[model samples]
Target chain A: MKLALVLPLLVPLLTAVACILAGASRVAQRALSVLGSGALLAAGLWLLRSVDAGGIQVVQLGNWPAPFGITLVADLFSAIMVAITGFVALCVAVFALANIDPARERFGFHPLYQLLLLGVCGAFLTGDLFNLFVWFEVMLMSSFVLLALGGERPQIEAAVKYLTLNFIASGLFLTALGILYGQFGTLNMADLAVKLRDQPSGVTLSSAMLLFVSFGIKAGVFPLFFWLPASYHTPPVAVSAIFAGLLTKVGVYALIRVFTLIFTADPATTHTLIVVVSVLTMITGVLGAAAQYEIRRVLSFHIISQIGYMTLGLGLFTTAAIAASIFYIVHHIVVKTNLFLIGGAIGHVRGTGELKQLGGLYRDYPWIGLLFLIPAMSLGGIPPLSGFFAKFALVKSALEIPSYWPVVAALAVGLLTLFSMTKIWAEAFWKAEPEGATGGTRGPVPLLMLVPIVAMALLTVAIGFFPGTLLDLATRAAGQLMNPNGYIEAVLGRTP
Target chain B: MPLQLAFSIVLLVRGHNEPGGGFIGGLVAACGIALHGIAFGIPAARRLLRVPPPMLIGTGLLIAALSGLPGLFQGQPFLTGLWGGSVPTLLAGQLKFGTPLLFDVGVYLVVAGIAVHLIFTMAEDQ
Candidate 1:
């Protein structure tokens, strides 16, 4: 009933068009970018507050009723996600001012960036399976252009890789949707949830598997995640930061959203499969990180590893477990994006991301080094930081189920994560610079760039300091998740 | 009638419920405009349009977005279809006065703008 549901998508859509309309004036584009993002942040906060207080909100497009019309639904998980999306978009928009080359700007980086946000917000807010597919395409289209925008040889090569794998994933998702629609005659997610309950056909199971593989590829799980590391490190850091922060999580959010709300008929077999995937994803991701010599590449691999923890939260499938996953997602988005931004700053100053060739950063730039250490340690689950609480919540949930294997995998990943962080610390910040090192002589790092890094770092520290509110929110989100009845009631106006 | 203009008019009029819409119709127009650009060159096309492509894109998008606002005023969802009570004019016949039709017009302008801009800019590049 709430009209606020539409704002999340509408605001971003308007912002994107505004950015495009600004055209050729980099200053105007930047101004529009900031203003649009600021508006989006407000919309996101407003959405979260209303959803948190008023409960799940569904906006029927053009006044059509549910199970028929395209709907934008805002549950707690979606609201939190939309809120964080605005924050990341705001930070990255500012950072791009300094980070993206002027050449890219002239090629319409600002508009494309806003379009990307539009697509992302649409994906988060959509309540129809088919609508989700459309949004995914929107996101993928913009991402493809953004990745290849600069036309660098590496950018092109990596863009092809990024584009190919994601296209396949989209095809798989679309195929899954086609089958589900054929069987149920509905694309509305809540309607599907009602119809598919207690009906576990072989066709349904196979379709579920298809969805798993599809979202897994996007989420960057084991064996399906090869494209992520190959391409993520190749983009400009701001682009990579947003990509790292939000893109894969959309896949993860989809996984959690669909499996919990629709595919609950065969949790025994499907959940088991996810658990095994989580273990391998963790082990392989950390191992991959260990082998990487570049800072971005190492961080890229860690993204896979950290994803395993979130999947572990999903695999456990308890209220607390899902809550932990939600918490983990927020913490990772902030910490990981900040890591990439800091990496960008280092590359800016030192002229390279090659770890061995980089050193003595702590000596010359202790402030930057300290900024790096906070997120890095938090990532490794250092005590009194964000990651530790996120890890603790997941492990505690695992123990409640007495599921030892995922707990073991989660613990080992934490240790290896620490090892990888220490490696980056030793090579990039602690050890002395290799003789005759040179970096970009763009003078000192500009305030525009530093501001985002510091803001994100402070946010991470604040999350560490005040875990109670977020934990409560995650708990409430998970509660609504475990029982989809409220969501169904909200959308359908009665129990199915 | 010119082949380009005839084809574009057909495509634009037949778009909404048919297979073709703003995208294809605009592409149709773009083909005609592109031929014009190639034949007469970029300067001639700019002179003919009387405005730049970027401006076209902006105005088109503004129209598209503004077309949705009235729905919000009526307490309905944004961009919901809204038809008019007015009798149709000769030109506006078959095309209802509604947000949906306006949206399509907006899309047509946008598609036309983007296609022409890319084509012209690339032409200038060479």
Candidate 2:
């Protein structure tokens, strides 16, 4: 059972080592990387099923008990997130085989990719705050190298900005951790939850604010998200796709976890700040997307807006709202990743991502057009898609809670989200290929590349169609979150 | 260079309970390699390493990961300390050699691999 508990994280880490061991054999590395991701997927699904069936699962590394040694605890939310992380890893590995160039592959892309997944799984599973910070550092360092892997001028430039901003966030995060640890004498989240509720302090609020700034930058929230749009467009499609799908969400996860678990002392203050920031984030993100001309840039801005939706539920802080948020995140991850892959596929065929330079994709490649439409319409919250239910659940919860301002922002952002998706649809797919442009069919997009996009798109459609079970899962996850007694008991035992 | 290599080896061995551990010892070892690369030139140093520096990373990682597996076999959690029954040591007093020490050795190799590879790449670039 403990072996099953750690497999989701252990598998990726071992795969990272295996990838490095393959050493200069790109073919060997590719095969190993794919196998690793497939293993990760199987482990993830197994953990999800087991956790879903059996409540929270806890395993202490090196056999040290909680609050003293690091614990890996997977509750409903964590198991779900890990399962999705593995799914994305599998899809991206397949895509990278076709999407990444040989030069990049030889530069140890496979190892770095596996390492990134390892860091992500580690972050999701670890129950210690300090361990979470360590995982953040692991993920950040690998991403920095991956971003600058090819050493291209633009990538190098973006890497500098990305690293610099994230370093500031990291520094702030570390400072907050130091402060919390100094005051509370514990870093185990459950222990902190038990401790902080009994002794509230001014330092806790300040420390929480510091944490917000750190996670805010990483989450790409308004006023701290400039680095996202600036650098996200500069990476390779595979890099951008994963970064778009997973990285910012880690910050959001941290925010949701800490707020729900430890910072309940003054939800009145922290939750209000969250609600205000979320509204601002929604407005600015959609507006930002509306302004971008490049396909990836538009998608990048929408990621910010989508993040706002996820956080809004946190701000609302109701069980239904949080469940809606969880559902929204699940829907958004698949949709956003598929959309980025679509952008990549178009770039594959047209040699550019500029909307002006791209056109008649619908005319030339109907498959790409259809693929784009599913996620695009889903993103816009069209009926009978995952995004619609996600948005509907959130809207209903917000209206019920009467968090009126965020509710308006959510609906307006949905409209603007649709506007930008159509902007992409009309410019990239609908309009005739401008004469003497990059739109002439270079060739069919590689089968390996197209397969992942289709898989994710079909996943979106499947979730939309059969959301009863998944939504029920989300509701249970939200229940576990709103009442974190199960999480606490799992970590600290019943009496403690 | 030989003295530095010997000193680093001592540090690596002495690292389990003492101040010097895998990271610092690895850096010390890399310093020795850097000195040799400077004196004898890089190509000769590269020839001496035999295996490429990057490959050392894989080897070191596998070693470190493998060190953690014995615990699982013994029905403990991953990475539990499984010390071999007490062994007496000169100067260091009682040194218990086991998986923890093996883990440190793995870390030593990994750090040395990374540091040397970085230095060599920069040196060769010039």
Candidate 3:
């Protein structure tokens, strides 16, 4: 059972090595990447079931036991995140197969892709704070290469800004880790939670704030999110899809883990900070999304806005709120990734992602049109879809907090989200196709790419219909997080 | 030219536990590559390296990220290190083996790869 936690991280690392040794053999690299991701997907699902049937499971590595060595933990939250990451990664891999040119595959795409997954899986499962930082670096490094993979003018420019800003963020992260370690003398998250229990309020508040700010940059929270829109659209579609689906959510996941477990005592400062940021993030992100004329750029900006929804749940700081946030994260990842892939397919067919150049795609590519519509509507929080359920749960939780402003802000964001989705639909799919367009004659997206999109879309709808299962898992996960004692006891023997 | 020398200094400073490590090392190495491209020509370097810079960067990141896994399940943080067993081996007498060493190797590869890539790109422009 513990091996389940270890395998997801191990499979990708081994596969990456194999790919490297294979020396750019396209077939071998692709096979290894796909096989590795498939294995991870299987492992993720198994872990998800185990968590659901049982509860949080902890694996201590190298026989070192907890608090002294490294620990991999899979609660409902981490398990669900791992599952979503695997599903999206598998999709991205298939999409890359179609998207990456044969010549480039030999370079480093397959191996890097596997390594990126390893980082993400590690981030999701690790029970320690410093380990999270390492995972972030791992993810960031791969992302830099992927961003610059094509090495076009825009890519280089974008990569420079992206790399520079994230470098600073990474530095800040390290500093924060040093501070946390200095303050508590421990980097293990579970142990820190226990040790921090009796700490001075000032120290606790400051440390929490420092950690929040660092993660906010990565999560693209308001004021720190300028880099996201500037760089996200520069990448190839597959890279953007994976980044959109997984990276920011890791930050959000970390925020939820820390705030709920470690810093639960001070709701006034932390929760208020979260609430303020949530509103601003929503408003600014929607405004950015609304202003964009490019498909991918709009989607990228929306990533910021949608993150507001998750933060809203965190701010509310209740079981339902956190569960809804988890649910929202799951829905958003799938829908957002699908939307980006659809944009990619549109670009592949239209020769550009620009709205002005793209038109009447719905008629030319009916399958893609359907695929895009599902996620689009889902993202808009239309009823009878996963997005609606996520929003509903969040809204209900917000209202329960009796916070009128947050409820109003969430409702408004939903409307704006719909508006942005419609804007894309209007310009890219509904408008008249330009005459003599280069991609007008291009065929429909290949089955491999479309299958994953459709599968995600189906999952979105299915979860919407039956929210009980996921809601249960998320609530259980939230409960575990809220009661840090269980986690502390699991990681450190009996709280002291 | 002076920038490369400065970068080397910074990398040295970063070696202990600060920010400088492999990533900075790679960037510095790239500066050196760029200098070579300026001195020589783009195609000449490409032929010499036999691969692109982005690939190198990718490979480096992969190696670096993989080095952290041993700690992840060991109940430590992802990149946490553990050292054990002084080797009583014939040649070396005693040696330390741990995750951080693996991470350092990852840093080395990533630095080398990115350095090569920066050089390649600069050379291409020249």
Which candidate wins on lDDT? 2
Q: In candidate 3, what are the lDDT values of residues A1-496, reduced to their tens digit?
A: 6666777787788778778766756788888888878877888888888877776788776557777787888877899999888888888888888878775686688888888998999999999888888998898898888888867899999999988878887887788788788877888888877777755478678778878888898899998999899998987888888999998999899889889878877788789999899989999999999998999999999999999999989998888898899989998998999898888888887779988888888787777877788999999899889999999999998888777898888889899999999988888788897776785328767776777778888888898889888887778888877777777776666755
Minimal lDDT window, size 10, model 1 chain A? A1-10
Greater lDDT among 2 and 3 belongs to 2
Q: What CA RMSD would candidate 3 show?
A: 6.0
lDDT of 1 at A248: 95
DockQ score of the complex predicted as candidate 3: 0.09
For residues B1-126, could you state the per-residue lDDT of candidate 2 as single tens digits?
Answer: 788877776777677778777888789989989999999999988988888998888888888888888998889998898988766766445677889989988998899999999999999999
lDDT of 1 at A78: 95
Give the per-residue lDDT of model 2 (tens digit) for A374-454: 999999999899999999999999899776777778888999999999999899889998898845258888889988998
Q: What is the C-alpha RMSD of each candidate to the true structure, in Å?
A: 1.9, 1.4, 6.0
Report how far residue A65 has shifted in candidate 1, in Å.
Answer: 1.7
Error of 2 at A294 (Å): 0.6
Candidate 2 chain A least-lDDT 10 residues: A436-445
Q: Give lDDT for model 1.
A: 0.88
- In model 1, where do residues sit more than 4 Å from their true spots? A1-3, B1-21, B89-95, B121-126
* Best first by lDDT, ranked: 2, 1, 3
Candidate 3 residue runs with Cα over 4 Å from true position: A198-200, B1-91, B94-126
